[model samples]
Target: MNAPLTATGVRFADTALAQFLCTNRYTSLDELRQTATAAPRRFWHEVVTALGIQWAKPWTEILDLADGPMWPRWFVGARIDLYDNLVGRVAREDPNRPALRWEADDGATRTHTYAELDQEARRLAAGLAGLGVQAGDRVALYLPMCPEAVVTMLATTRLGAIVVSLFSGYGPDSVASRLQDAGVSLLICADSFQRRGKSVPMLDDARAAVARCPTVRNLLVVARGESPAATPPDGSHWHTVDYQQLIAHVPVTQGPAIHPADTPLMLIYTSGTTGKPKGVLHTHTGFPIKAAQDQLMAFDLKPRDTLMWVTDMGWMMGPWLVFGGLLRGATLVLFEGTPDHPGPDRLWDLVRRHDVTHLGLSPTLVRLLMAAGPAALPDALPDTLRVFGSTGEPWNDGPWHWLYDTVGQGRRPIINYSGGTEIGGGILACFPGLPQKPCAFAGPIPGIAADVTTADGQPANGEVGELVIRAPWPGMAAGFWQDDARYIDSYWSRLPGVWVHGDWAQVDGDGHWYIHGRSDDTLKIAGKRVGPAEYESALVGHPLVTEAVAVGVPDPVKGETAVCFVTVADARRLAARPWPEWERELAEHVGTQLGKPLRPARVHLTRSLPKTRNGKILRRLVRSAYLGQAAGDTTSLESPDALDHIRQCRPAGA
Candidate 1:
């Protein structure tokens, strides 16, 4: 076993995790992970107490594992509500403290203190109840990242209704599908939002979607940008209610309902391998506790810290930030537009202006910012910055080091986090007090029983295999909404009782974990298995290449061959050089970095690759487009035109 590389050489003494260890008398990380994994009930009880999570009634039992690990229920016989823990308790203790800070694309900023936010949520909750929204009714929120979005989420949960948070960037068809699937009764949205300095209409898309969703009875709109005065539809059965008008007549104080701990709280939908989106159900005690624990244990969030993640409300991070930050009494910073809009340094400028303490971003965003050169970066790192966080996809060394050395200034740690919507928070994360490698996680999160396993389901160390969870946590969704069979088949069918997360993972000899890539994207060449991230990393290591995506294509002899699509730093200079020489050189470079057998069959050059709004490269869409097949369910794609570019640049006979 090689010694773990200490790339950053940074550690904190007064972090939340450090305090937890000192108070709990745990000597090391292994002790904490092992104890937490072995005794889930005691760990969660301590966590709830440490976080000061308010409950209407205490549970008699911490966990009921009688249903098996896949369906373990936590907090039996307890009554609680998410709003009570998130807003009620905090607003009572510190009414003047800031709870949320919001900024629009044009630099318009707004601040909401705990008192003001609680008042708004109460008024909105009363107004929603007046509109016939009852407990168990589903309300769809398609608004942009703003104070109203946060208010609506809290108010819905307070009223014991389920929140169906939709992405603001989704089109009419995509919105319609989710609304229909959830049987949503009311929709809250913005009239327009600014993106890249342009007013993007949101209500029109909502109206088009509502025309197909018969369950929606009311449409509440918040006016923004230069949207035309919203007029109630003349002939439609449903009514349009102005957001401000509805809340005007309601009282500013309303108590939240105390439901059982397992009461359904929200439904977050994530796409499956078959391209169909599944609604993942979370409960009062499920998602919020898991998210708060991650912030407390991994990021070491403090009350004085101001955290921001460049994300939209449609993504999991949206609700995650809302509950995680507020529950821990940390101020949340929300931005409602593109991170690099108007200029490449826009995000850096925000960090400086807001004095952001923890800045979270995607590696793809880092690569985009890097393309602007050093001049586009701030002259110095913000003094308030303490932690840099990343998620969404696996990172390559080029961007990871650039973030660690340049953005963090060699003093802060990039808390690499990886998990899915179904997992609630993070399955693996780098702890604040631990020494970190370039892109490696220190270990599995304290409470998660995570491991890498071989094809035969045996635990594998220092080798690549499927990542699986052996124990159930509070965060596992209460079965995919309305589809218990699909939920079991998706995660448990592969391995009898374990949750088979479809990602290729490896644990180094030093016990640090690294995610290779998605297991479904694995390629078999000459009977040897490899992840596309390995090849893509080697290709991006080239000085000229900025980014690359590798896909497996049919080959007569090797069963399958590697084909790469890459974008370069300078397209004009490369075009002027000899094409055949460049292709051969790039292919040979990959072969040298990896083995010869894994060499790409062909290296295709393209202007861009299709990606999601969150900056995840769509390798499946790329392969589909290259093979001239239907690119399934591209509703999540940010730039569908990038697919057209790839198809246009297809090899002569590909």
Candidate 2:
């Protein structure tokens, strides 16, 4: 068992969660969780009141469960708007304080104060309203991590329209499919953005998408940097407008459009690893409130701190950072470049320049940095960093310890956060005020009511089981957009009166929880079920291997055998000898570590594995591509050619 990380100088008394507990007459988080889970209505009421949630009108009821456990209405009959709470409230309190800090790949920098952002959002709101955008209309924002992306999101929400944000890396087909599904009336995009020193023509993709999406009538384009200003396609049915010119107009929005708390605010799609991406609908109150509560109560984030997560808008974490950071009155950082671009020192430079306090990264990114920049990385993290936040995927102890030892110097803790788009923020998260293990979650965030159960729906106390929630939280997706039956079948139908999140989870005797991997990706060999993370952890433990992905393939004798693909950090290891010898050695090493019963069937050396823009390995795609099966929904991949890399991998004796 790993020892919990000791908090040296951090005090629980100074945290916002401490005040929240004291206000509710609770002495500790455990007490609060017990009371909150038993009486969710009272807990939510007290929490909202204690936090001084910016409500235009007080709520009549905290929760209405008449709709059923799968669909719980929160803050019923209350008027609240995200624009008022996230930007306007902060601008009123401290207008000159920085709300957002942005830096592009080419060293372009911009900082927006709370007041400035408020005005810009209002200006664009008026521009959109003049173009016949009305409340409840859907507006799709296909933009990169630029200032306009932030402005357009706020502006659309200010007018009470639902914001559908697409990941910037998507192609025209991905864009058009979502546009038609949402029946979006307006599409906002950038002319171009930089990635790996190459100009990505976002406008070309947007135009092609709009041409295919008949529901779209107006195209709003932000001419990025000094790139040649793009012209609107001639003889198009939709109107084309300039984004900066829209912001230059007179500010016409007086205040937020009044709407009930349950009004739909945004529609975000899941990263489609399973199949087609499912649309998750979030209300104005549900997602934002849950995000702020999770960030504040778990990490003790303060307004004085700056937070950054290396992610793109297409993933859930992008909006999670924006809403959670801005609502807490913290400086939000946005980066538009690759971490290894220009120099491996880019992320470190951002940290020192911004004095960032909370930095979020994926375990995959940590492995990449460790392999790519052993020499370029600093001996210690910047002094300004108070916490290392991580999510998107599970952690193996090798990379986790390296980050904790090398970058953090054993002082700071890597707060392992685990959740997904459907959960809003986190199901299980580590608290900075408490002790922590290498990759164990401190437990369920207070009031989340998470549990573990076997596939047969039996209670699992000390063993791995399906991660589930007994009660609904504010952050859960209201429902799948236009597919309520699919939403029920996805989560609720799996178990009675429970939301079964599709991840293998375990809680040890010490009460620390750990995610194994996706249950869908779990491998069953000789009738022994094992999570891919186990084999993956052992494979990456090899010195030459930097990253790895494990998948189950058919075997006539054994039920299913594990086929592992790995990327080597040192090219010299490959050129030095035949790869088959080393492959057998590495496969035997996994057997030695995890036992022969779980040893992989084959270890294939691949140049690169397919991944999402957020750096999560898409195991489904890798497995399909290896079997020469159709790779479904390759649009979310960072590089389409990554699939071909898997196909081309021909390890000897396979």
Per-residue error at 273 for model 1, in Å?
2.9
Candidate 2: regions farther than 4 A off? 7-9, 225-229, 273-275, 650-654
Backbone atom clashes (below 3 Å) for every candidate: 0, 0
Q: Ten-residue segment with the worst summed lDDT in candidate 2?
A: 6-15
Candidate 1 per-residue lDDT, tens place, 1-654, comes to: 323444343455678888877778889878888888888888888788878888888898999989887788899999986787788777888888889889999899999998889889999999999999999999999988899999999998888899999888899999999999999999999999888888888888999999898999999988775554477578875789889888998877565678889988899888765657999999988998998889988998988589899988888998999988888998899998888888888898889888898899998888888877875587787778888888988888888888887767777888999988999989999987577778788888888999899977998767789999988888888888888998888889888779999899998877788898899888998788899988888988888788899999899899899999888867777867887788888999999988999999989888888987778898888988988888878777888889998888566886
lDDT of 2: 0.86
Q: Cα lDDT of model 1 overall? A: 0.86
Tens digits of per-residue lDDT, candidate 2, 144-184, equal: 88778888878877888999989999999999989988999
Query: In model 1, which regions exceed 4 Å deviation?
Result: 1-10, 227-229, 651-654
lDDT for 121 (candidate 2): 86
Q: After aligning candidate 1 to the native by TM-score, how far in Å is the CA of 297 from where it should be?
A: 0.9
- Among all windows of 10 consecutive residues in model 1, the one with the lowest summed lDDT is 1-10
